[model samples]
Target chain A: MNLFIASLAFSVVTAATLSLAAVAFSLQFAVSNIFNLAFGAALTLSCYAAYFFFSIVGIEFWLAIGLAVLFSGLFAAGMSAFLVGPFIRRGASAFVLMIVTFSLGTIIDYGLDGGFRDNSFTLPFGGSSLAIHAGPFELSGAQLVVVALAVVMTAGLAALLHRTRLGIAIRAIVDNRMLAGASGVPTRKVTTVAWFVTGLVTGIAGLALAASTSTVNGAIGDNYLLLIIPAAMLGGLGSIWGAIAGSLVISLADNLWGVFVGTQYEVLIGLLVLMVVIMIRPGGLAGVISRGWGGT
Target chain B: MAYYISTLLVLFVSYAILGLGLNVQYGLGGVLNFGYYLFFAIGAYVGGITALGSDKGRVPALFQEIYAWNLPVHLPYPLTVLSAVVVAGVFSVGVGLIVLRSVRDDFGALMTFVVFLTMFTLIGAYANLFNGYIGISGVPSPVSNPELWYPILALGWLAISWLLVGAVTRSPYGRVLKSIRERPDAAAALGKNVRHYRLSVFILGNCMAALSGALLIGFIGAWSPLSWQEAETLVVFSIVIVGGRGNNLGVVLGAAVVGVGINEAVVFLPAVSSDPGLIPSVQWVLIGIITIGFLWVRPRGLLPERKAKWPWIDSKPGEVSEGNLLRKLRKGEARK
Candidate 1:
């Protein structure tokens, strides 16, 4: 029972970090309708960028993180504006777009692998010893920060989506690009802004994940996709709240499996959950919810 | 020099077979199997295990202790390869049935990729299955003079694969498969069983991949988790894309050019740095660029698929093939 409670607490932290990336992924898909298979690579790029800024350039940790997040946002925006946008404009099929993003991911992943020329790098978080015990949960300072950041970001995003014109434009584009364009929403510009926002979230999520893990590698983000994709898909590909809910469920399931079964098979269990969920309800949890509420 | 040539030949044949399988799945049936290498890995593992025999004493003591399960008997080379094909085929059927149920083609592709990653994690974690990261090695080669006979054996297998793929792609059934690839709804409306055709192609393609793996293990004498990373599947995709998506002969050309040619070319480059990983990383980056560049510049590939025409229909003016539109315009036929 004690172990289970600890696991539950750990899962909440994990879910908080996971939800950021899942929502970002969902938002990207929502706006572009492309799966953005390179998303994991983008996350990895942020980690590497932070590493570069902190270690190589002698920047402070917090400042380095800010710069990394900025760089990642721009990189993602550039990818949308230059690489994916042109292909999409040329009317590439979904399969072709998948290949394009996958190939782009390969370039980034291998580029990092070659440039780094090391198996793994350690980030100097220097806060592993700082732990906080809240009820049954024991979490590091970084983990607590991650959880708090998630809460603040989620609330901020809600406000932005509900209160701002840009957010409204993004929502319109997601709902219907053609219709949004017809309504003079400047669909392309709004979509790019949406990509940038998602990229910022992805950067923070990657940094949080790196801080928690302490060790970073080229494949770190790629491996995290094992969790991110399932969470995003389970939440319904385009629903923000669905993504958050899905992340919680997946994280709980993963932590529970690690506690009961072996930690080694946690990833496998997550994937199995995705497969079963996809098989049973192709539209995901959001689909069920929507249908229940008399939505098409 | 002779040995190097033989190795390259075997590799070329192996890649050719893999390319053909992917061409069948993605090109003919429009099933994007991102986990194509999983079937190949399965074949290699099964083939290696079956040939390794039940004698624990034959292998290193570490492997003996690490491997949870062992085949009870040592099968002959033919039977080992056959077992690989059969096992991979069965596994593909299971995966295909589940994955093909997704309404979206891209979703199915992503599921296949997820399946690959899941299996990769499973194999790496479960050391008992294939001895973990150390992988299975030390299977005796069937050929006494491998240098002389292995290439010949590989060529024989390639010949069989070629004939098989050729027969399937050239027949009337192949036309239906093509129709499904172009327009699944239209094919369904025409009374063709789209799902059945897809599943069949999926199984057939996966079996070929397995056969290639079996053939490869016989030459390399080892198989491991490190051998079939997710990116390796992209290499086969590159072969199919660079050669020609729907063209079998073009796939062979692609295997030679992209698989063997680029690989050998890298071997000759002067080492720029002491880092052992640099060349391979750069090579992969190059391949990714080439794939994207080709997709953008020449989507049809070096040798595009020939337009199939009905022999009974009389020739009609101004009915130019898609690929020959430029030529038709150059010839001033559009004015008529």
Candidate 2:
């Protein structure tokens, strides 16, 4: 019972961290129709930014987080505008976009390696995470913060999409770009903003994930990629709420598998669950857009 | 200097073989095979294990930490290489069974990446299965003399595989594979067995991949997980993409450029800044940029699959010309 509760506590923390990134990743696909394999690099890039500020410059943690988010968002927006935008303009398809993103990822990840020399760094909090004891389970201060942030972010995003004009425009762009463009939606500008916002969320997720893992490196994001994909796949490709639910299911499955089986098979178990889920649902948990093979 | 040049030539040839295999699978068949190194590893390990006389070479050193195996069986080199090719080919059949069901290109790539990583996890984590990361060593080479053997093997294997590739590409069988690659649904509508062709090409390409691995192991006299890095697949595939797809000579040319230019350029540089990563990181950054640049701007590659051919034949020039091209130049081939 105790072991089960501890695993549950841990999984909630994991789910909380993953939901932010998963939803952001789903959003990128939704608007741009890109797989954005480089999103992994964004995660690493933000994590390193946080590490640099928190560990090297020794700033307030929250301030460092803010800096990282702004930097990531700006970088992503700039990338979309300057680098990726031209190719798409030249009539690149999703498949070509996937490769393009892959290239960007390689450049960013390895470019950092050359600059930073491949050494692993940790987020330098002066002290450890505050311990909290409740019933049979124990948790950390950061863990609870993770849960709160996830709830707040999900709720905030839901409200934004539901209530705001910009959110409606973003959705319009996703559904039918031509129709949206015909209806006086600023499709290109809206897209840039959407990219910026998703980039910020991705950065936050990266920061949270780095904290959860307790180490940061260029390679760290690549491994996180395995986890992020299942989360995004579990949640439908484009739905925001679906991402949160998917994160919970995947994280819960991963922790339980660790408890019941061995940790070695944890990743495999998550993947298998995703495979089964995707096979049955096909549209994902709350699929807004149904995907067909070999289609635009 | 001779040794260095020979070693470089040998590696270039091996990578050329890899490029050729990828050219078939990706170029002609339209199957995205990102985890190609796994097949190479399968061939290397199978060949090494076959030629390796005793587990005695590994057990004492390996068991010092983890698991041990007791064995004694060494096959002849010819049989060993053949077994390697056959085993890897057969293994790919099993892989194709599952992967071909979904035609989503990115999904296929992702699944292969998963399989690639899983292979490492299994080999690295399980001490008993692959001796757990210490790797296998001291497999017997095919010939006693390195001088004659290497030069012959390098040129001989490249020529042989190039010829075989050429033959397959020019056949009517090859014609249908390209049709499937261009339009699977349309090709199927025309009564072509698209799935079967894809799988056959996949299996055939892997057979060549295995053969290369076998020869590579023979040259090095060792086999290990280290030899087949996942990135190696992408690098080799990038060569195919950079070389003109559907052209064997172009693939070999691309391999030589990347093999010597980007990969082996490290040999010349003075060690800078005591940081071992500086060179490799720069190299990867360059590779990533170059691949993307070519893919984005010049998708057809440096030497685009040539359309010009012998004036006598009036078929489309690029569809494997039959003006007595060696290997693929069989007389009486069906013309459109």
Candidate 3:
């Protein structure tokens, strides 16, 4: 029972970071309708950027993180404006666009691999040893911060989508791109902004992940896709609430599996869940909710 | 010097087979199989283990656990390659049945990617399976003088693959595959079984990949997780795109240019630093750039697919073609 509680606490932390990434990923797909395979690379780019600022340039830790997050947002916006926009304009099919994004990811991933020439780096967070206990759960200071960050980001995103004009524009675009354009929404500009916001989310998620794991590497984001893709997919591709709910389920399953079974097959178990989801419920949890109780 | 040239030729031939396999699937059939390397890895492991036989004593201590199954039987050279092809074909059939059922093409492709990652993690985690990360080594070569004869053997396999793919591309079945790629709904409306065609092409293409893997393992004398990275599939995709999708000749040229040329060209670069990974990293970045650049500049590739012409209609000059006549009649009827 103690082990279960400990795992539950860890699962919450994992779900927090995972929700941020999954929501960001889902949002990108929602606006552009392109499955941006390079999103993972964006996450890694932010982590590395933070490393560059703090370790190489000798900036303060929090300041470096802030700069990294901003840089990541701009980078994502630029990718949409420069790389993805042109290909979409040129009448590339969905599959071709996916290949294009995948290629872009490869370039960024290997570019970092070449530049760093090292496998892993530790961020100077200096909070791993500081443990805190609340009720039956114990989490480190960094994990608690991560959980708090996720909550704030999720609330901020919900408010933006529900209460703001830009959020409505994004939702309009997602509903029907042609209809939204006919209704006088600046489809392209709004999409770029959406990309930027999601990029910011992606950056925060990357940092949270790095803080929890204590190391960052080139394959860090790529490996995280094992969890992020499944979570986002389980939530339904483009739904924000679905992303959060999906992350919780996936994170809980991962931690519970690690506790009950061997830890070696945790990734395998996550992937199996993903396969089952794809096979039986490609529409995901959101689809089920939208369809009502008796609808298939 | 001869040995070096032979090695390069062998590499080129192996990649050409891989490119042809992908061309059949992605180029002709329009199936996006991002996990294509999984089949190649399967082929390599199966082929290597079969050749290694059941002699656990000779195997490394780290990998001796694999022989506990006592099912690794030593086969002749031809039988080993055949077994690799059959195993990959069967596995692809099973996977294709599930994956091809996806309603969306991108979803299917993503599933393939996930499957590849799953296998990679599973194989790496299970020590008894493919000896985990250490992989299998020290398989006997088929030919006595491998340096001289192996290149020829690999070339022979490539020729067989080329001929097989060529025949399929020119046949009526190939045209049906092309139609499914162009307009799947239209093909289905015409009573063609699109799913069946995709599954068959998927199986055929995977078999070719397996053959290429078996041939490669025979020459390299090792098979491991390190040998078949998930990214390796992109290299084949690059070959197909750069060569020319749906064009066999262009795919071969692509294998030569992208596969062999870019790979060997890196050797001429002056060592910038002692870091062993720098050059390969740069090489991959270059490949990514080239792939995107080609997709942008020449989407049809250097050798685009030629328009299929009917000899019966084109052979007679100054004659009204049946296709044009039918269109003219339809236009006339519409006016009435």
Candidate 4:
């Protein structure tokens, strides 16, 4: 029972961290119609930023996180405006855009590799564990915090998207760019905002992962790329709520698999799950339920 | 001077071979094979194990890491290379079976990347497999005497490989592959066996990749997991994209340019060596900028795939529709 509870705790924490990245990935795809392979690179870049600030400037944990988010947002916006925007303007199809983003990812990854000199740094945080019990579920304070943050972020994002003027405009742009443009939505500007916002979320996910693992490296982002794809796929591409649910299911499955089986085959298990999901439910879990995973 | 030239020649030839394989898949077949380095890695390991005779070591390797075997006295060096290609080709078939299901382009790329990392991790963690990171060393060189004859032999091998590639590209099968790239559903409607063609092309490309890997391992006289890193795959893709992906001659030329440029430039960039990070970072940045720039400026590449024409038979240049030329131009623009 304790082992089961512990696995659940682990799953929740993993799901929490993945939610931020997965949501951003889905959102970016929703608005821009580009599968940004460089998204992982952005996460890595920000993780490095946080590391640099904490180590070089001797900043506090919160300050480092803030700096990382800011830098990542700016970088994302800049990339969108300069690199991605021009290609979209050229009438590049989705397939070519995929390749373009891939090349961009290579550039960013290699750039960081050169800048950081293939070094690995640890996130400086050391604390004793605190445990808590909620009914039959025993959990750590860290796991609780993860759940809290996930809830808060998801709610915050939902409120922002549904309530805000920018959110409506973003939706409009996604639905029909021409109609949205005619109706006075600044599609380009909205895209830039979405990019920056997505970057901030990605940055948070990266930091969360760094904190969890206590290590940061350029390869760390690449490591998550595979995870992000499956999450988004399971959630249905461009579905925000679907991303959250997908992350939960995936994290739960992974944790349970770890408990039942060896960790060495964890990835293979995930891949197998994804394969089955793709074969049986191409629309994804929520996609099948709601049938909103079409058209795009 | 001769040694450096020979080294350069060997590197160029190997990369050229690798690039040609990519051109067939991505260029002709329109399959985005991002995890290309895995096959190359497999080839190197296979060739090394085959030549090394038996597993007397502590760790098991790929296939039969613990298998007891010996390279017979009668088996020639070329036969060993052929053996490597065949083994890697078999591995590729297995990989294709697993990943070749109906998948989106980017999804396929991601899956390929996953396979690459998983395989690497498996090899790295399992010390019994491919000796983990210590890597197999002291594999016998392809040429016993690295004198006048070695370069000639290597160049001759390269030429023969080129001829094979050229012959395949010119065949009706190659023409259909290109058509499949242009429009898969349309080709299927026209009675083309799209899946079979793609799988065959994929396996064929892997064979070429394996052959290149065998040659590289032989030249270096060593093989490691690091040698077939996923980055190597992207580097080859860049060469194919930049050199004109659909064009055979252009792919080789692109490899030559990138290989010769990066290899020779590293000699002058002392800071890259001193810092280690400086050179590689710059190389990646250059690759990115060049790729984007090529897509923006000339997607067709430096040497665009020229349309084969029979001037005397046609006798009409102006009357020929520009649709094919336009398609070529669009493809060239995609290089960016």
Best by the DockQ measure: 1
- Model 3 scores a TM of 0.95
In model 2, the clashing pairs are: none
**Consecutive 10-residue window with the lowest summed lDDT within model 2 chain A:** A287-296
Prediction 1: B-chain TM-score: 0.92
TM-score of each: 0.94, 0.89, 0.95, 0.89
DockQ of all candidate complexes: 0.55, 0.50, 0.52, 0.47
Candidate 1 residue lDDT tens string, A1-296: 99999998999999999999999998888788788889899999999999889888999988998999999999889988888888988988888889989999999999999888666887777665778787877898778888999999888887888799998899888777888999999877887888889999999999988988868988888788889989988888788888999999999999988888868777686577678866787667886323221111
Q: Considering lDDT, which of the candidate structures 2 and 3 is the better prediction for this target?
A: 3
Error of 2 at A221 (Å): 1.1
* DockQ category of candidate 1: medium
In terms of docking quality, model 3 is: medium
**Rank by DockQ, descending?**
1, 3, 2, 4
True contacts kept of 3: 0.60
The residue pairs found clashing in candidate 1 are none
Model 4 per-residue lDDT tens digits across residues A5-59: 8788678889998988999888888788777878788888888898778887789
lDDT of 3 by residue, A1-296 (tens): 98898888788899999999999998887777677888778889999999999988999989999999999999999998988888887878888888888888888898998888667999878776778888788788888889999999999999999899999999888887888989999989988899899989999999988887877888888888888888988998778899999999999999998888968777776567777877788777886323211111
Cα lDDT, model 2, residue B232: 61
Chain B TM (all candidates) = 0.92, 0.86, 0.94, 0.85
For residue A141, what is the lDDT in candidate 1? 79
Higher-DockQ candidate among 2 and 3? Answer: 3
